[model samples]
Target chain A: MGLDQPLEGALAPPMRNGELAFEEPWQGRVFGMAKALCDAGCFEWAEFQAQLVETIREWERTPEGEYASAPAEQETYYNHFLAALERLLEAKQLVAGGAVEARSEAFAARPHGHDH
Target chain B: MSELKPQAIRAEALESLLIEQNHLTAEAVDEVIIRYNERVGPMNGARVVAKAWADPDYKACLLEDGTKAIEEFEFEGGEIDKLVVVENTATVHNVVVCTLCSCYPWGLLGLPPRWYKDPAYRSRIVREPRAVLAEFGVVLDDDVEVKVWDSSAEVRYMVLPMRPDAAAAMDERAVLELITRDAMIGVAR
Candidate 1:
């Protein structure tokens, strides 16, 4: 996902014919959550984008097995990404308050994990 | 105590005689599909959304917290290890992704459709959501900022797209039609 590529109205979709697509709606959810998070000041939009781009570039460059079995490295990158996601979701909920109980309860009903 | 002591037989002898057992529990992917087939489909979400559009209190409650709001219909993202719901209000919308090998909440949504787990999307969307959405035929206004989520672990997200005015009064099926997969993710109109 090159930030430089523009895909708005006048341009062609950036993806190639055989390139993978996203599940609609949910795909859009990615941007929506991020935007909401940024707007709420959870993090600066520019900074967030910069981090993701850097991470993506680094991963793309390294071979998958290069960091294999090294728990520290895997956790370092993956955990930071998850943390960012959590912040975004929290901000979105904060902005849209109401009927929060049902949502909270629904989430609670799901298996709450304890990391090994 | 006898001089000719009897040696103990190894437990391996007993274990080797037993037959191997198989499990009924489905793999993560299968379980994901089963849940999608059983619940968490558009109809279910539509019911909740319908309630929100019609009832301010419920909508407020849903906006405040989605997991509990969804339970009103006895719908639970079974086996979905994590659930994160994002609603699109007049001013904001939401989207989701699994940046590290697709750690999604299958419990809320059955198996992630292939594209979500695809390299192209997971690789591109986070960096270029605007361009990706355009590729998918969605054009966002420049002022309406787009946010991209990168998932790792069990956490997963769902976008509650703002109900389009044109979809008003439409049946659940009708309304869902307008809720394109991309739109639900918050990259489109």
Candidate 2:
């Protein structure tokens, strides 16, 4: 399948000269990571899209007013992206279940930039 | 070492697993990070804006064909399927958002600001752009028409911010410095 077909209606209609926008460094990181994973054959693009569709559906079920009341830090779409990715990786056994959660805790405890 | 957020940690772990499974290499992971940081950014867009400001022909070309004009800079990524450059004029202002999902021009403007992808922004910007702009401390005159562009995965939009008066005396490099990602996104002037 082509890249455009699966993405159709998955997002809003394209505006002229529009590009992918990232709000934070991690947003781009997550995007790049997902692309890298897809390139590596961990899962097909369609599989990830399925997970994403599921994630977005769950998010949409929340009452409209709930978003206004939610904390400022909780509004990242990439967070959902990560959640969906985690689900896929676990289902595929590409990474052991809970491995990411544990790694998250470890990094949070030490909190050091791992660049390079 | 700087502090690593939980998201960063998760990403690191994922990369490691990919490497361990022979799916990717450490070098490849590093290259991705570097690409996001250096290869793509607002600076690239700023240069295009600066060039447009300096040359009317270039501006016409940019407004006519954003994708081809941007390629003149020799940016490596081929992610943008189509690009549309909107001009912010005296009577018209343009702001962009993706209500369904966060689709933006990563190749030109780099990652969007946190607020750009916020649910509040996605839902509110289209309905009341002037009010949204005000909240961002950009209170335009009432006479100006605000055009809200909805971006998708196929086509991305960038605002060609009006060149500031100060830019008239400055070189292209100087003018480039004055262009912020938010300005290009039409959240700020």
Candidate 3:
């Protein structure tokens, strides 16, 4: 069927002055990484999407405060999105398993105000 | 400066690791982000909304076949393939959401805002739309019907808000200013 049919559901996105809003730089960066990787054919877009939805669903099923101090809802979702990407990369052998965790821990140890 | 949050660090780590492996370049990742920031965004959707507000034939075509009609503008991205344009009349209002994951009309609306992807919105909007709309400062009259469009990866939706009475004498260019990404998503009037 054509797209003329109205698919009704309640909807609204956080906005600032009628524009798409981003709270942090990494939110966009991680999103870009996923898009860029998929575009480069590292993995199919649908594969990432399926993983993302699964991650969110798993988060939803988890009990409250189970996610390591419970970040804001927005951050929480992106965290799951990030995890999905990591999982996809590891599964595809694009990046070694646990390498992201090791790398992140190393980056976290840098002196204050020093992020490369 | 405060320490970078773990998630941010993880994101950066992923970027750096991918770059190190040659699977991706920093420039390519930046290009995707830059494209969203500068080029592909709601303005594209606003142009479509304005065109529909101005040309009757185009409006009919848009309503009949949104995917084919919007191609006239040559927007980038495959998300528009199943584009569905829903109209808001005096008696009805429309909104868009993706409950499973955040599937938005990226070519038209840009990346969805944080709330759109939050569980609070994804779970609540379908059950209590009026309450949710009220929070967004959109209070419909008791008689006006509200229709929520649940977007899927295959078919995306955008709302065509009614031309405000004030813009009657104005041209399409002027009307374009009246359309916001929020309104096209059925959040604002």
Better of 2 and 3 by TM-score: 3
C-alpha TM-scores of all predictions: 0.50, 0.74, 0.87
lDDT of 1 by residue, B9-126 (tens): 1111111111111111112223333334445444555565666766779877776776666665776544333445677766554567876665554444434545664566766788
DockQ of each: 0.02, 0.21, 0.31
Which scores better on lDDT, 1 or 2?
Answer: 2
Worst 10 residues of 3 chain A by lDDT: A2-11
Q: Give candidate 3's error at residue A58 in angstroms.
A: 0.8
lDDT of 3 by residue, A1-116 (tens): 11111111111223445545556767777888898998888987778888998887777677862443322466777788899999999999988998989988877776764322
Whole-model lDDT, candidate 2? 0.72
Better of 2 and 3 by lDDT: 3
Per-residue lDDT for B1-189 in model 2, tens only? 545456756766665565667766655544665665566778888888999988899999999999999887887544577899999999999998977666778778865665666777888898888898999999999899999999876688999999888999997667878998889999987
Residues A1-116, candidate 1: write the lDDT tens digits. Answer: 21111112121212222332222222222333344344445566545544554554565567763443322232334333433443333344432332233333433343423211
lDDT of each: 0.47, 0.72, 0.79
Cα lDDT for residue A19, candidate 2: 45
Worst 10 residues of 3 chain B by lDDT: B72-81
**Model 3: runs farther than 4 Å from truth?**
A1-20, A65-72, A112-116
lDDT of candidate 1 at residue B176, scale 0 to 100: 53
- Compare the candidates by DockQ and give the number of the best one: 3
